[model samples]
Target: MKFYKHAANGFKIVLERKITMHTTEETVVSFRRVSKIFNKKIMALQNFDLEVKDGEFISFLGPSGCGKSTALRMVAGLEKASEGEVQVFNEQPKEVISNTNDVAFVFQDANLLPWRNVLDNVVLPLELRGENKQESRDKAIDVLEKVGLKGHLKSYPRQLSGGMKMRVSIARALAAKPKMLLMDEPFGALDEMTRQTLQMDLLHIWEREKTTILFVTHNVYEAALLSSRIAVMTAGPGRLSALIDVDLPRPRELSIRTSNEFMKYVETASNHLENGSIGRELG
Candidate 1:
């Protein structure tokens, strides 16, 4: 394959001739010197700066306690930044949190209600929003089908496998049809085979829905496979260490993991991750 290079924000970017990932100049999320402190004692993030473009899939790859989840929570309006600013859709996250159509979050756990069936769990968000009953049910069914859970609509959380439960959780998020999905290790708990399957499923859903995604993953391979860019963070008092652009061709298959190009991307990300951790220790 042919290759070309370009520069943006002082960083070099390389792309393959067949690269198909699409992101616009329009900024969807921005963090300017943002920081997060818990109880005024512990600092989770410091001087974190990032810009997420429209339709981009970005992953946070860092060691544990690097505040990846904290950053995501701030984007979700579940946590407030102690310093600087965080903007989602060009507005303060707090300003848009009330608008259900703007953001959706999928956690590591399915967090499904045991008493509710699959369809009911998926429909719950719309219900809480006081949306029309029939429309909500229809949307739920549609998203459930998208996640390959149509036939299991009546199944309870207890009856499904770990992967299936996560699918239901994702379906619940997608049913809202949000403009962006904030996923915090949504597939980290599953087995390797199941994680690969769901990773493919997620890519398909992302391509079809055209939804921007902010994913957090500890797995370098997963980050390289799923992200348009991977943000490597330093250990505690987490900050941006490197923002590695993943220029892999889109519609990626599992087999791509073994490709030289993909391995190179993984190596780059892994190096950044290790350096970031070491830098924190030295500081």
Candidate 2:
């Protein structure tokens, strides 16, 4: 167990040890004084700093334009910081992403192939990596089953529900057996009932796989339900406003979300975003 502190403007940050059994005690993602700008005028991020520990689940909780996705992109090497640095496994994001098997990024939408079956979609990454067709098929089947899509491997994207498609997306990510998973509001589009259901399913997947996850979501309850720590950010030149430790017991069931203790953590995180971003954004 280790305590890591990050100093940044307008907020104090402390990364509590994740209560998970991890093989390594290394930092998975580190953002050092990172800033990102677009078109030289729009500032997507400003002096952002975060440290993601191994096997930890982190949620970037903020508004729609708070650079939550931008931060996630930086980790995946989809976007680069204008200043400072973002290191994945203490290596460049380009290096990690180039390896293909080191990281997987899941977007807001399922982004599944309409023409392909569920198993085919999940095996696409492995095929791209030049694995044997039969071997890839086996890996895809295993991941789909792990994600509760065992009976639907032959189903196409159009045949599945909103939640099911997202499940396929996750299954695809897992098929490659990546070391880290980066999710940007993967369940944000689902209906409330579906969202809650998937949240619980996702928690189960996280526990079973034990991969490092950097999830970006604005929902207070979702962050509280899923993350070990929530990094609250302010909008318009987004920056870390607070890093709140959840400190809740894990192997958690969806029932925990209804508990008073759970709501208390939700309220605390909600207040931090409220005081840091919502309160000022309205002005």
Candidate 3:
């Protein structure tokens, strides 16, 4: 495997090429020559390969129809690849979903129940598993605090700002203390300022939690900001286009976004995205 390592600020990230099938045992998640087709007419993914380490933050970036969400859904066990396999913690995603409590997903919308308070929303997953209410409540509160929502534990989703609602959603995901986080444009609905703020906050939480995260976004800047490695995808019939290691220093504040190095990476990835159609067809 080819490994790329870089240190910025205090954060260090390593990105490695997908391991061969014989070496799957060493990876936390592996997508082996995977493909997905819809209606036998529309191909959503094609010969894709990906491997994620135990605690890395990675992003899948492309345009709206690029099948980024499909890739994530497959990993979440919500969809199955038409060809090849997807393994989580060396087990199939379906197996992981049935037997383990090691993955969580944060969707674009908060998806919080209007009837549930912040604490209750955060504890719902644990509650479903028969965990004690009081214990789960305490765990929920701790994660809420981590997400900067401690004082708003009793607040309803309607009473919160879009950003705050997203925080509640994040708190709920973290409450599970999952080994991996699957985020599908989790901040897409927020305004620019709110999105940027939450992006920073997410980095802080990811740094502390050391959770392996697979984030999907169309925003080049957002992906560059939060990912240790950005995996650019081709247009529908999506395939890995480029796997770029983000070398910007971490505790990455907004200033890094303006730096020449940052722009270089973004521009390169943007070019790949722009040319995705041609690339996919040629491949």
Candidate 4:
């Protein structure tokens, strides 16, 4: 195992060796002195610096308008940074998007086509790239089953419940066999019970697939339950306030959330956000 360190704003950031069995090479996504401004007046991000390790499950936890989504969008190449650079796999974010099929995105909404069946929705990415219809269909079916949607392949998005639709979205993202998955509050709209169920399902999929995930969420418990590490952001002009390593044991079951150890990490993360320590630390 190899260790890497990043120096930003005079702070030394060190990443621990991953304990997973998966051998995928460690890829670091970093924001180097990155900042974003709208109309030259409003600052969305100010000198933001963060590093995400390959195959690691991490979350961006902050209040709305904290630039959590903006950071992800910058990585997705959907938005441009006004200053500094955003790198993925050590290449520019745009280069990563255009030159390789290494990333996939899941938004707050399912964004499934209402007219398409679950299988077709999952196959859409492959189809767009002109893969064989028969082969793509086979792959999509496999991924749908992986997401626990095997019985719903023929069902349309309109016919499925909110949770099911999100499953379809996740299946579609996985169909491409992406190295990194970016999720923006994918379960935020569901009921609490449904949200917890999906969270468990997501963790299962992450473990099985071994894909690096950058999940954005406002819920502290959800972040604690899902992320191996949580990066808390400040209120505005967002920057990394704190990067808390979650020492929770893996193959985590639902009961784990109620354990004292789990709540301790959650409370620590909450305190960082509540006391505005994140901003102060960055400053």
Q: List lDDT for all candidates, in order.
A: 0.86, 0.84, 0.83, 0.83
Candidate 1 lDDT over residue span 196-236, tens digit each: 99999999999999899999988999999998888888888
Q: What's the CA error at residue 240 for candidate 4, in Å?
A: 0.9
Query: Tens-digit lDDT track for model 3 on 1-283?
Result: 5443332332222335542211223568788999999999899999888888777788999988878999999999999989999988878898887777799999999999999999989999999988889999999999999888899988898899999999999988888789899999999989999998899999998878778899999999888888878888887878887677776776789888888888877776687688644334234
TM-score of 4: 0.91
Model 2 stretches with alpha carbons more than 4 Å out = 1-24, 277-283
Distance from true position, residue 26, model 4, in Å?
A: 2.6
lDDT per residue for candidate 2 within 50-121, as digits (tens), equals 888888888999988989999999999999999999999889999889975989988989999999999999
**Candidate 3: stretches off by over 4 Å:** 1-26, 276-283
lDDT pick, better of 1 and 4: 1
Q: Write the per-residue lDDT of candidate 4 for residues 196-227, one digit (tens) a residue.
A: 89999999999988898999998999998998
- In model 2, what are the clashing residue pairs, if there are any? none
Worst 10 residues of 2 by lDDT: 4-13
Candidate 4 global CA lDDT score: 0.83
Alpha-carbon shift of residue 16 in model 4 (angstroms): 7.7
Index of the highest-lDDT prediction: 1
